[model samples]
Target chain A: MKVVTKDKGVYSFSPAHKPVEYVKPGELIILETEDAVGGQIKSEDTPLESIDWSRVNKATGPIYVEGAEKGDTLVVDILDIEVADRGVILVVPGAGILGDSKFEPRVKIAEIRDGLVLFDGLRLPMRPMIGTIGVAPEKGEIPTATPHRHGGNMDCVEVMRSARLYLPVFVDGALFAAGDLHAIQEDGELCVASIEVEGRILLRFSLIKHKAPEWPIVELDDHYSILTADEDLDKAVKLASEQAVKALMRAKGWPFEKAYMFGSIGVKLAINQGVDPKKGARAIIPKTLVTLNDLLIESD
Target chain B: MKVVTKDKGVYSFSPAHKPVEYVKPGELIILETEDAVGGQIKSEDTPLESIDWSRVNKATGPIYVEGAEKGDTLVVDILDIEVADRGVILVVPGAGILGDSKFEPRVKIAEIRDGLVLFDGLRLPMRPMIGTIGVAPEKGEIPTATPHRHGGNMDCVEVMRSARLYLPVFVDGALFAAGDLHAIQEDGELCVASIEVEGRILLRFSLIKHKAPEWPIVELDDHYSILTADEDLDKAVKLASEQAVKALMRAKGWPFEKAYMFGSIGVKLAINQGVDPKKGARAIIPKTLVTLNDLLIESD
Candidate 1:
């Protein structure tokens, strides 16, 4: 397997960026990712004022996939995410929901050991996840902090180990990058930060020609989910739910109303990152209610 | 044990409503609740246009608590919820996120059997929950379809068996009423409906003088959650997160900023009912992170 280290990371998603490495479709890769703050906070005593905001969310690649082209789907099967020994979570003055007026800056460093992230006396289960992953967009450069169709900083907890993330390929080579690993995070991530951490991610990549999804799609053990991002959380939710309903309509040949109703009865709308510049929402449809064979396009 | 049936159901929450029954603190009661539409749709073939909009959401009581008074908390420990044999889910025009623009009025009937909801060959696990539960408000009457400080149609799935719901007592007697049972529902209930069913609810009541929450709270096996409802989903999320932070600050004697940061790392904000007129959002904090003894005010 090929290995991509954090030293080769980029801070933005752009089609103009050259690939750091090239690998064939269906190849496995091990990616070493930096924390969301890009290793700036080294200890609990590190001052939040000393950190550079411009250097945050550095993604680990634009790993070129051989034979991948525009209008195709880039399938990244997440096998494992091993948390680093130490991590830092910082709540700065101007960031997150409470913002500057209500909250002063603070930092907490956590240690990963014995299947838990230790924060003083509190021990939370270690659930490592990739916070940002995306392919190159169509034209302009998008900073790594924003999430859109090119899937950046989604911050969804379900984007954990064993989930398969499917990204739409807008540019040739399907330039895929990922980083900002977290030890654990609750849904909504209301204050805009989780247990920010560093980690090693293992993934297998494949291409589905001419079958691109409008937004990122994640296939979990028992469900299929579509993620959408927008400034308005309600709009994000509506967009994601619409995608789910479209998939159901295509698969079951049901009317839009029936598909929408089925979504109401079975699909779960989850908040991914509520405090981001582009907040994200997801519609998760249980696989038990609809089979994989039905959801995927037959022509592909 | 006393039993209250749907024959004593009311369409609004008001302190002036007479109590259909009375029970002392620590006494058990079994209540029979009608569906959200007041049992309007009987079968799959039932016309969506026939449902009377004015008669919807008939909650089954204003069951008076013998000793509950103003400025207190009415504790209702839910023991069990047995779903009825059949239920209806309707998505009508001019309702839900899709409303009249993208979706047409439609109805679905699901059968409850063998601990599953049978819907068109798909068997969904039976997760029975109370869609509405509340004490009468202090002021003017509020419809049964809206949820607020005096909890109404929260539509939260966690309010099921073995959960304890704490509602604020604004007036004397803590006139409690509950109905609108659901056999199964997703978190957001996006299309404005669920497996709307009737059910028998078993509960034990208690009163905590001068310790009422600003919103409804639920204590489950692994977590404690505060539910908030508003027309703006973002505002609702903010309100719920604030309540969670307040609880954390009161519990650990931490400053507001530290408590808010703790909430950002550990508390989960979940959408309860997005399609309702008053959108619902809940902040859930894991019990492992904070003990019950620390969260409750001992002075009460």
Candidate 2:
């Protein structure tokens, strides 16, 4: 078992960065993560303007996996996520879906105990999830705050423990990185931030050779979601829906028309993170209808 | 109980139409509805081009409720949905999210028995819902295929039995109509059609005088979703999120910031229908956090 500490973090995902640790396929590893704000907000009384914005969204190590190469799909199984005792949620002045609305910069520190998030005498269900996770892209560097085909900062709710994330591999050895844990987050992450927390994730990686999806996919118990991001949700949803329909067509060995019609009865489209500049959307296909093999297309 | 038969249906919702039935606020009524295609696709062998497109989406009634008037919110509780033994699904040549894509005008009829929608050896979960339900608008007419503040063909999955739908009243008596039943449908309704079925809906309407929202809303067991539709999903989602944040602000009596921040941890943004010309989106807020009173703004 290997463990990458929180101190080793990267501000962006790029092939230029050296791998912090290297492991063989099927090897189990642990990733220690810092909060999205880089632990800058110490308490509710902490001034919001004092923190450095550039240092925010620091993701932990690009752990390279042997045998993971370009034209392959990196399957990372998230086994467990253990969050810290406390987390923070913030409201920024000009960030979020409601950017034009005026608001005082406020921060609230929440307690995490007994598998519940306690805020103002209310107990919220704890649904721990990874907020930022990605591998190096084929070409350029992507900031930790954005999500692209290579998967960065896709604050998707399904990226939780007991789910398997399928990221398209690019660059040899597959420099993978993940951080920004949330104790509990709803689908949209509407106000720009969630109950951001420090945590440790236990995961294992495997490779699907010569097959990769156009975008990242998350496999859960009953469904697989195709994730996409663009400057707006319309483009993202269109791409996700198209890819999902294609996968369904392949799975059922049917023409595009039948698959397209059947998708209305089975596939669900949702927003993952609405507040980011590149809004994230997903097309969730039921496992009863499609499979992992259907989503990944072989690249000749 | 008064019953509105399927034969007395209207193609468009307008203030110019005559009310078929009248009832008190608390009185329950049954609405007999035709399928989205006006019950024309009787079997899989039926040609898709044979059906009259102009007769599609015929709502059963413009039921007038006593004491219901303009500037009021009409709250209708969906008691039960009794679907017929058969349903039809279709893929029109150019009538879906993938409208531009080439496809044959295909039609498929499904069997509904033992509380299940059986389609081609697959037993889909029966989640019968209202596809088109609305009151007459303040002025002019809106075709039943489009959704707006008046709540026409929202295609929202949550508009099922046990849910409560809130529609804003425009003209006096809240001239309400509901039809277009779906035996089962996913969130996006990605394709043009779903398991369209004829059904009977049992519902009762109550009113909140002088209190109305900017859009229609659906109240499920654990959450309330504000529904909005626009030419694009981005605009719909933007308006929905802002309204949800505003509701939170009223619920907790907190200034804009705290409610906006907490909304990130509590609210969800989702698509109800993507195929319609006006894409429908919603902001689902947890019932544990906000009450229905918070959503109904005083119009006076």
Candidate 3:
């Protein structure tokens, strides 16, 4: 068991980034995270425009998992999330889809209590989710705000409690970082922001040697999803669909055409988020249609 | 009650297309439908390349609803669907996301019996849906293959039994056409086709005078969705999001920003289909999130 608290988080996910903690597989670790803005906006009086943009989206740690080699799959199962008393939401002009339009930046403080996030007398059920979680890439550095094969700020809401996220290891001792917690967010996060909160996350890690996928895969209670993020949503969706088709092919021992046909009528494509930096599309294949045993690895 | 049987279906949706039968509002109608390929591909011997593309996607009727004038909303409530004994699925080499990649054109006939579509020794529960359904446009013709404001070929799987579809009326008599039945389809319909089948459909129509949305809206058992179709999936998603925001604004009597914020975390965005002449996106707003009274129409 390890409890790692890195106050100074990294602004990017890179192989060059130093690991804050080292732990073996089959271990439980606790991570304390800062908000997406790196704790810049404190209260209602905090001016949104005054925050430094370059210092935002700081991820907690590149926790090195021992014995995790390149091409391995890092299974990070979410155990629990404990949110702070307050969360921040900002409407920054020129940052999201509403960018181009001019308006005074607005900041609001949400109180997290009684299993709800209360803002301006409106109550929203608390569904805490990690907005950024990834492993170090093999090549150039990718900003924590961008999402790619290495899985940066995907902002997918489905990566929540009890979900198992599988990340492909690109370097030896897979450098994993997780932060940017949100109390609640819809599928699109269309406002370019969610109810950002600081929280402590509990995760259990396991390594599947040589079983890594090209992108991230999330196994939820009801379905398994292949998450793909690209600036162009069409391309993202295509990639996700291809990944699902590939999974079907590998699992069912079917040819490409047969797999493609099955995917067309069996896979469900969901939009994780469709605005700015990266547009995410998740191809969700229901477990009822394809059991986990069917998706078992042939070798690895 | 009115029974309209138009064997000669139309390939396009047009304001000029004559109505096969005219009926008063609140009347029930029974219409028989052809498949997406217009029932041309019969068996294994059917040549995939020789089928006429011009005659594809044949919708049974532009059955007119009397007193359904422009600016009114045509409410088509799907009551029932009776699928045929057999259905067809095709993997045309040049069609869908598989385009540019070469593969032998494959066709499979699925047996619809005992409430399942049996194909390749696999049984899929029959979830018959109307793939193409729309009202006439205001001006030019819209092909039944394309989904637009007039709601042509949406190809959404949610438009199934017990759902209510709202289409904006643009002509004196709302000319509603529906066909392209599918025995079952996943969300994306990635292979460009589903279990295409000929079927009989029962619909009940009602006119909401001077209260219509610019785009198509579907009221499912649990949620309301605003459907948008564009070649670019991103733009389509944006449009759908905006529509959901608009609904929230109109329904909750909130300002634009408040509605947008509510929509960001409360609504769900789904990809109806991402590969084709039209990339479909649906912003699904759960009924639990917004009450019907909040979505009250301000005007047509």
Candidate 4:
């Protein structure tokens, strides 16, 4: 397996960035990713406010997936996420869901051992997940700070190990990149940060030809998570739930009302991160109720 | 166990209504609830639009708790929810989160048996939950169609069997009422309807002396869910997460930043229902992470 090192990090996902590594479909590779803060605040002794913002969210790669073309779906099976022994979490005063609340800058370094995140005096079971992962957009570029149609920085907890993320291919070769790993994170990520850690992601790339859902989709153990994002949380919820209903209608050959009614009883609309510029919303539908093919029904 | 029949239903929760049923603390009682449509539309035979809108959301009782007072917290332990054999689900064109979407008014009658909701050629596991359950507000009357701090029509799926719901008392006797049992429902009732069904709710009432959470708090088997509502989802998300962080801060004697950071990695902010007049949002914190006392730390 080829390892894409952390030195090949990109600040933004763009078609302008040339591919640093090339691999054929079904080729498994490892990408060494840096933390969200570029792994700069090692122990939090440094002031969080003075850190260079430009160096933030540095993602590793624009790994070219051969045979992945525009209008195709890039299938990335997340096999495993191996994290470092230690990670960092910080609370910046003006940078979270509760940004207006009076709070000083605080930081904590956590130790990962025996499958638990040892923080302060509490031990939480490790749930390592990828926070930033996607391909180039249709036109220009999307910064690693925002998530949209091309799936950047979604911060969805369901993007963990054993999940398969399907991204809409906008540019040829699916200029794929991923970074910002979290050892563990809650659903909303209220403070805009989690147990940010550097890790190596093991994933295999494949392609679904000429068929792609409007937004990204992640297949978990028992459910399909429709990842959709918008600046407005209400709009995000609309997009996510609409996609689920549309797909279910297409799958079962049911009319609009039947699909809409089934969605009310079957799909869960959850928030991924409310603090992000493009707040993440997901529709979690059980595999027993919906399938990968069902979600791709709107393919053009 | 004493049973409170379905005929004692009220269209709105109010201090104006006289007590219909009275019970001592820790006394188990059953409230036989009407469907959301007040059992008007029995099956697909009746035209959905033709139903009497005036007779909607008929909840059962003003079950007065003997010892519950204005300053105390009324503890309601949900023993069991026995749903009726048949339930109806309808999609109205001008209602719900996707209200603007082109859809016809379609009704589905689901059969409940063997712990399964047998729908249109599909068998789904039955998970019954309460949709409208609350006490009277401090001053004015609130219709059963809207949810607020007083907790009406929340449509929260976690309000299911085996969940202990803690509500804040406003007036004497804690004038409690509940109805709108859903045979099964997703997190966000996007279509404004689930498997709308009538059911009997078995409950026991108790009191937490002079202490109450600002919003409703439900104790599930593994986690404590803080239910909050707002006209705007962003505000609801803010309220839910703020309560979680504030409670955690008071619990472990941690300062602002520490609690904020912990919340990002621990508390899950979930959307309960977006289609309601007041959208429901909840912060789901694991029991091992934060106790019920931690959440009630702000009580005076």
User: Could you say which candidate leads in DockQ?
Assistant: 4
lDDT (Cα, tens digit) per residue for candidate 2, span A91-174: 888888887787788899999999999977789989999999999998779999999999999999999999999999998988
Q: Write the per-residue lDDT of candidate 4 for residues B35-78, one digit (tens) a residue.
A: 99888886687887679998889899988899887868888999
- Tell me each candidate's i-RMS in Å: 1.4, 1.3, 1.5, 1.0
Fnat, model by model in order, equals: 0.67, 0.87, 0.65, 0.87
Which CAPRI category fits model 2?
medium
**DockQ of every candidate structure:** 0.68, 0.78, 0.67, 0.84
Pairing residues by index, what is the TM-score of model 3? Answer: 0.96
Candidate 1 C-alpha lDDT tens digits along B66-135: 9898878899999999889998888888777666455667788888999989876778888999999998
| Per-residue C-alpha lDDT of model 3 across residues B1-300, encoded as one tens digit per residue | 777674857888888998889888888899899888888988967988779888789998888899998888889999999889999988887677655566778888888999998867678789999999998898889989999888988999989999999888889888889999999998888889899999899999998887787689889878988889999888888888778877877766767666666666788888887766888888899886666444435463
- What's the CA error at residue B144 for candidate 1, in Å? 0.7
The alpha-carbon interface RMSD of model 2 comes to 1.3
Worst 10-residue lDDT window for candidate 3 chain B reads B291-300
Q: Report residue B39 deviation for candidate 1 (angstroms).
A: 1.9
Question: Which tens-of-lDDT digit does each residue in A9-62 have in candidate 1?
Answer: 889999989899888977889989989998999887888889998889999988
lDDT of 3 at B171: 90
Candidate 2 residue pairs that clash: none
